[model samples]
Target: MAEAVARTSYGRLVARLARRWGDLSRAEDALSDAFERALRSWPGSGLPDQPEAWLLKTAHRRLIDGARQSGVQARAEPEIERLLDELTERDDPDALPDERLGLMLACAHPDLDPTLHTPLMLQAVLGLDAARIGAAFLISPAAMGQRLSRGKARLRERGARFDLPGKDELAARITPVLDAIYAAYGTGWDEIGASESRVRGLVGEALYLSRLLTELAPEIADVWGLYALIAHCEARTPARRDAEGRFIPLSEQDPQLWDAALISQAENALRRSLKLAPPARYALEASIQSVHAERRVTAETNWLAAAALYDAMIRHAPSLGALTARACAHGEAFGAERALDSLEKLQGQASEYQPYWAALAHWSARAGRREDAARAYDRAIVLSADPAVRVYLVKSRGALLR
Candidate 1:
């Protein structure tokens, strides 16, 4: 229970401190000291009535002590005292604003390098370590660490405040913010755990953050669309693995295990997004997922409809993942041969991409090109980092050889 609370509340605590101190690194250091104190005191004194508030109060004192030790100017002492007074006066921990949203906006600031936005957000908001984020971004751990350090340094040097953007500036920052949320969700989605609980925790954090964003910006169509998209995918969580803990492909997943409530929520969110103006990429993707979700009642996939939606999505988004999904949809709607032809056009471009090889293997197998299928599967298995996915690919290749 302590671990769970720590996972969920750490970001909020850090965000609150970062806002108050106006120094992300210093805030983190103070919090780290507070946690160490908790580790030692909690085991002896028993758990505090309110762990979060206890941590906050401890962190507040640590910050002040550090300031004094560093010989902070007398001019700032009164301000620090005021902050301390406020902390002491607050009885309800729940009253604290979820400053994590503001921190996310700060991480995705337009002034920062665009490429660093998602990685920095993942680290600062979700507490993902550099190695995990490095895997997501396909960078070396050393490089990822250096990049994160540099991004934080830049924010400090620029005196970037941990605050949400004003109405006038909010629109421009929306894309990066949304992208960072999805990137976090994707990391959770692909994670392979000994049990589903670990994966669920990360995915749940991402969903929580997305929901928070929607509440903050309810009028944004893409925000609703993103919420719907994640909800739709999350609805299928139970069916993604079997009783024996092996991975199950979407097509083979038992519909009965899907979460009906989540699907309903997804549908409602998608409807709300559709009511708004200008269709966005996320909305289009949600629409596609909606069609898949329909199989729960209809007992069949509408491949033709999905193919059309993918075509539209490609026109609007044009991502490699979208293109790969489109090819799979085409294979279902049209035929494996045509899908192979389309995938061939992307050969050199997507050669190193795991999904590309996996798709090629599937299509080749369907087209009766046994040798090509085996080769493609071999490549996919070699490139896949997720143990479950790698195992699945190996089993698939073995079946092909048999």
Candidate 2:
């Protein structure tokens, strides 16, 4: 119950508290305290009728106590007074205004390091932990924790506003906001059924943010592009596994299981993005997804088109994921031998990325490099967090032995 509340209401609670208290770190600390209190008290008192309201009221009190105890009451008098004013209005936590977007933008403020923006938004807006955000960025949890602490302190020191920025400022901070949303979605998408990855629930939150962005910034092409890309991916979730819960790669999945409505929505968003601007990073990615969406009607994926979009994506972003995906797409479009050559160039950078090893194993097997395929498959399986994916890799490896 607490976990579910944390997954759903944590961001809303934090956003409200941060705006009222004018301190992101304190907001988070107070909320953490509220959750701890709930854990200790809920078991004995039975579940509260309104968990979010309960948590909010408790956290509000915590903020007041902390401010008074730390000699911050005078410095934070106005915020504290506002908190007290809000204390009487805590009957319906759901009625509290959602300031998550404002909070996210604040985290993306230019004063903060650009690289830290995504991690900060992931933590502040989606309630993701440093460990989970670190996993997404390939940083150590301890190091990520330190970085996040510094980021919060920096935000406070710089006095980043908790309100929405002006149009020009919004544009400046919007890129990292989009990146953070995509990163959050990717983290959740990858962790599907992995028990240790509790943040898998964040996928819905990411989608919610994307939808909100499309409404808030209708003129921004990248926002629609991201929405389209995410919707396209979500549309295929039903087909990603077989009846027995075995993993199914995109090429082999039954397109009949794909959500046509979502594909249509994605296509419409992609069209909007293209009309607004040339295909940039997210736009290029959405185009790739659009090509895959075509497979539902054409009954075949256009690897050449996907490969071309990936090449274009590299020109824009050149992210390891894009590069690795491009290699796999080229392998499908050209030949396994050619694909293996493309992938070999990225071995140094691909060592820790599971998709790279999986693609390498597939192309190696296609190229009839039995030993190399076996080794790559072993590594891919070892790195895979999804049990179904590991099972698929094991089966693929067993086929080599036969």
Say which candidate scores most in lDDT. Answer: 2
Question: lDDT for every model?
Answer: 0.81, 0.83
Residues 215-309, model 2: lDDT tens digits: 76788889899999888888888888778878788878889899999999999999999999888889898899889889899999899998988
**Count of backbone clashes, every candidate in sequence:** 0, 0
- For model 1, the stretches where C-alpha displacement exceeds 4 angstroms are 1-5, 42-54, 111-115, 128-147, 187-201, 368-374, 386-402
Global CA lDDT of candidate 2, please? 0.83
Give per-model TM-scores. 0.84, 0.76
Look at candidate 2 and tell me the lDDT of residue 165.
69
Most TM-score-accurate candidate: 1
lDDT of 1 by residue, 182-272 (tens): 8667643422222244345357656877787788787778888999999998999999978877788788888889999999999998998
Q: Could you list the CA RMSD of all candidates, in the order they appear?
A: 3.8, 4.8
